[model samples]
Target: MDPVRRTPVVVTSALLTLLLTVLIVNLIQPVDAARAERTTAAGASSTSTVSVRRFPKAHHPSKSASSSSATKNQTKQQKPDPAATSAHPVDWLKPSQQVDYPDPAAHPGLSLEVSLQDQRVYVRDGSELLYTMYASTGMDDSTPRGSFRIQNERGDHFYNPREGMGARYYTSFLNHGVFLFHSVPTDSKGGYIKEEADMLGIRPGSHGCIRLTVPDARWIMQSVPTGTPVLVK
Candidate 1:
């Protein structure tokens, strides 16, 4: 009788042990799956951080680069245009109203050069140009082209009855009184002729003299010494 009862109790104990084993296995499997999910999520986050650090934002120009470009543009704008300056020349018709007299004592090599083509006179010390003056030479090549010494003949005023014209501040350079450096044409009453004065330095209008401005003629009459060499070309 005791053997049969012991067998039933043993069977019940075996069933209880099997149920507890299954419950523990189910709990451990869920915990391990959750841990694996957390590890995978952490690894993905680290990979995303590395990707962000590897590549930076797009590049932008610095302030110094922009300023250098601006400076280059300004330099180009300030440069002078040679063509523009050459197109516009000085107007010589207007009176200079200013004269810088030369000191023959300080400049012993000073001489005069006349340019018939340019209608200009250059006061030169050797090769150095000291001053420039506007002038009108004789028409039809009446004035001689050669080196001439300034003669001792000079006058304050004169008139030619045959030519019906006259001039002032005359200084003879050739033929004593034939070829002279004088002021613009004047009337018998000593008034300057406007039409002839306007032609000064522009074209040849004189009969046989080199015509100059009033101030220029006066300066030559008073300042230039005798025996000075004058070259006409």
Candidate 2:
């Protein structure tokens, strides 16, 4: 028998290619798994951020704005009364000696009477008395007692050289321009002399003029006209 020959085994191209393809697929599978894990982690982080940002905080008014609103509401609630803004008319008959006057249209209309003894002045409309007020007349019988008409109505105030003081609302008498119905003595600049206000209606305290309260003097200047009858007794 001839010597038996051993056959040599050889790798074919198709088998080698199949072996390489299987090895490449095994390596790529691990890379794909790692990429998928990273993608899932990024998706989870993005979803968490979106969830936190979805709802916003509520708004509140600032401190100054709240304070201003409160002030406005308080002003509306505590508004001042309209009647308080207007002054009430003076009550002229509060004194016990007042006698109500007749209708304002009576003939021989409004007149004035000055009583030195009583230290009072009276306003009359025709035969009826209208109002009476305490007064300060001349000291030492200096205020002349006689009937006289107002000759002139001067300024709201004037200067008196003899008294070295000022007077307001001069309603001059016809007998002598020096004598008049006026307010209590004041300074040269028309400021009230508080000392003179204290002496009013208590006794005779003027040089010669009839001294009245400031309001009474102003009322006479406004209402009483020149040429009105005045009787001083």
Instruction: Give Cα distance to truth, residue 30, candidate 1, Å.
Output: 49
Per-model CA lDDT versus the true structure: 0.82, 0.74
* The 10-residue segment with the lowest total lDDT in model 1: 87-96
Residues 1-233 of candidate 1: C-alpha lDDT, one tens digit per residue: 68978998999999999999999999999999999999999899989888877645322245666788899999998888786664222233333346566777778887888889878778788998877878889899987898998888999999998888899899999999998988888998888888887777778888879888887788789888898889999
Residue 224 of model 2, lDDT score: 75
* Residue-level lDDT tens digits of model 2 in 22-124: 9999999999999999999999999988877764422235566789899999998789978777533222223324344333345368888999987778888
The residue pairs found clashing in candidate 2 are none
TM-score: which candidate is best? 1
TM values, all candidates: 0.60, 0.53
